[model samples]
Target: MVFLKTLAYITLVLPLVVYLILNKRNNNKPSRVIFYYLVYSIVHEILVYYLTNFTDNISDSNAIPLLYAIFTIIEFFFLGYYIYDSLKNKLFKKVLLLCSIIFLITALINLFFIISSGVNNQLIDTIPVSTSAILLIIFSILYLFEEIQAPKIGFIYSNPKFWIIVGIMIYFTGTFFFFLLFSDLSGKDQYNYWIINLICIILKNIFFTISFFLPLENENSNEFDSSFGINHYNTIK
Candidate 1:
């Protein structure tokens, strides 16, 4: 399973790295948000891997705070970037607006509760992770909007894109549930913590595997189009 997990990482992230590097070289429309996210993932993966060696010490380790901080920042940036992209497209604008409104209301409520109390850092930590997971699902759905305009051009409902969306949704759901369940593991039963961790790891690996083959299939399609026709609208990323 450890080997599988490492393979999953390569599968999921290698394409992303390739995409970013290729786009940068080709002057294609590379997303800076994704770039930063890639960096965050890399750093977080390294830190968390090392920190795992000190399992008994995780609760008080600097790694915990650092990982939380990095993930929170990534979540905020992802939300902002996704919202912008959703609004930029006509088909997704309404959906994006609704999500934005809902998020803002929830955030205000969380803030109100925080201010009322003496500032509960634990609960505050939950907000961004929870909200980000929800927004990522919305973003996955909103991603299909581009397909409405040019069905043949980009990765809308195509095989790879479709599966990738499914993978992302699964990942987001899994991650959010883990956060909600384990945020206060100190008070939970040992079994609960172990179960959540086990389930989360399974889901993470599953999502990673799904994410891995996504790029190659899409790349293949683009290559097919290029060979057959020049005007094959090749902006599927």
Candidate 2:
């Protein structure tokens, strides 16, 4: 478990460093948002780790659920926006926006009303996490579909957005069932299954790092605009 934990930390930290380096060269909106997400994730992890280790009082540990709930809300919004900005399909974009709004409303309700009544807000608020995962899965599929329909621009794997979508698909798909079942799991079961989440997270970060290393392409170029029917770079800006 210790080794697994260490590996997970390295995976998370390495991606952040990669993003920072890449951003220094040329920081696009999507990459900047993802970099901020990684920084938030690292800080949250450190806070949770130290708080759990240093505190004897369980009530003080309520910080974990609170922090996680807040993070989930912010993460869902930023990631959903990133996907929305990347896609060109009008109908799909509307669908993404509608779903995101619904998810945001649901998450707000869970955070304000349901969370306080539960021993752990994170467990009780699984709906938001699960919903976010499902929406992301849908967006990932849509992104891939768009990619397939678009004219081939060099190697598809070389596209940074392709790797980002791939990472989202892998992470969200792996954790979809986990988050759905999280509230139902016994303490021991939750502890045991956490390794699965950690493994998925590591894989996601590895993909993210790879994406950062890929050569930056001009998102507003004529090829991309003709294929996607939108100037994604301008849209993002």
Candidate 3:
């Protein structure tokens, strides 16, 4: 278990290191947001690791769940914005924004009122996490469909965002049920099931590494013409 956990940590950190080194030459908003997300994930994991090891009281150690709640909200915003920026359909973008707002509001409510009142916030609050997974899975499917519907570009496999979304889809879809059961799992069950999450994490990071290493393209390049081709649209402009 320790070896698996260590491997997971290595996988998580490797992508961030690769991205930082490769992005020095050129950087874009989406990639920068992804880098920030990766950093936050590493920090969150480290904090949880230390807190779990040093703390004795469950209430005092509720930092894991609290951090997860907060991180889920922020993660959804970053990923939603990335997806919105990647797609050209105005309706899809609006839907993504609306869902993100609703998710954030729901998460805030969970954090403030729904969870245990005091500093502990012991409740894992899987509602927001599961919702995020489901919504992201849906959006990822839509992204693939959109890609397929549009005229062919360079091999879809070669597109960096394609791999990133594929990673998201696989991770979120695989973990949806796990998040639903996380708060209820026994210690033994958790230990057993955690490998699943670790595997997904490794896969997600691998995809991220692939994305970072792919050749950079101008955000506004007219390489493909489609009403839904987000690569051609310059959101910054």
Candidate 4:
């Protein structure tokens, strides 16, 4: 668990370093959102680690759940926006946007319930995290299918969009079951299970960081971005 948390912090910070080195020269709407997401994640993870370890008062309170609930909403917004930008179909985008709205409203309701319940049970507002994972996973599969159908796009590994979505898949799949089973586990078990979550998040951050460093589209490359149809570089904004 200690190793995983260390890795998580390292991986989380690496992306920020890469972004600073690139200096937004490679920034696209998708990458920009990803960068900000990393920044937000670093802050949240630090706070969680501190509150969970240093403060005895938080162990039995709703503090952790409440903090995570709010972070889940913010995380979903960034990822949803990423998906919104990556997908090409107008109807899909509209549906995704609508789903995002509904999710926010539902999550806020959950937050309210959590705050008012005064329950000290291990139960959390896992609905938001689980729902976000399932929704993003489904949409990511849609995106991969979309890529498979495209005849002119280059190797999937070479596409920046591919890496971003893949990172989402990795993070969600890694922690999905953990969150699902969280309420059923003993507190000690939950602590150990968090190692799994952290490891996956580390990979997600690594892939996200790699997306920024990959060779950009040039006249000689076969890379075709679905969002732009062609190599429309800086116009993604």
List the global CA lDDT of all models: 0.54, 0.80, 0.79, 0.81
Give a tens-digit lDDT track for model 2, residues 79-161: 78778888999998999999988888888887776456545534435888888899999998998898788775566787887
| Local lDDT at 142 for model 1 | 65
What lDDT does model 4 reach? Answer: 0.81
lDDT tens per residue, model 1, 1-237: 455556655644665655555553323222344445556666776777777674775544444554554555555556456345534476467666676667766665655554455423352256656776788777776675554544355444344345445555776676676666556657545334445444544554444334333343343344335533655455442
Whole-structure CA lDDT of model 3: 0.79
TM-score of each: 0.54, 0.87, 0.86, 0.86
Q: What CA RMSD would candidate 2 show?
A: 6.2
lDDT (tens digit, per residue) of candidate 4 on 12-107: 899789888996555667778888988998888888889889998776688788888889999999988888887877877788888888888999
What ranges in model 1 sit over 4 Å off?
20-26, 51-58, 79-83, 90-125, 145-155, 158-167, 184-237
Task: Point out the higher-scoring one by TM-score: 2 or 4.
Answer: 2
Q: Name the candidate, 3 or 4, with the larger lDDT value.
A: 4
Q: Where in model 2 is the C-alpha error above 4 Å?
A: 59-61, 118-124, 220-237
Candidates ranked by TM-score? 2, 3, 4, 1
Error of 1 at 174 (Å): 3.4
How far does residue 7 in candidate 1 sit from its true spot (Å)? Answer: 3.0
Query: Which candidate tops lDDT?
Result: 4
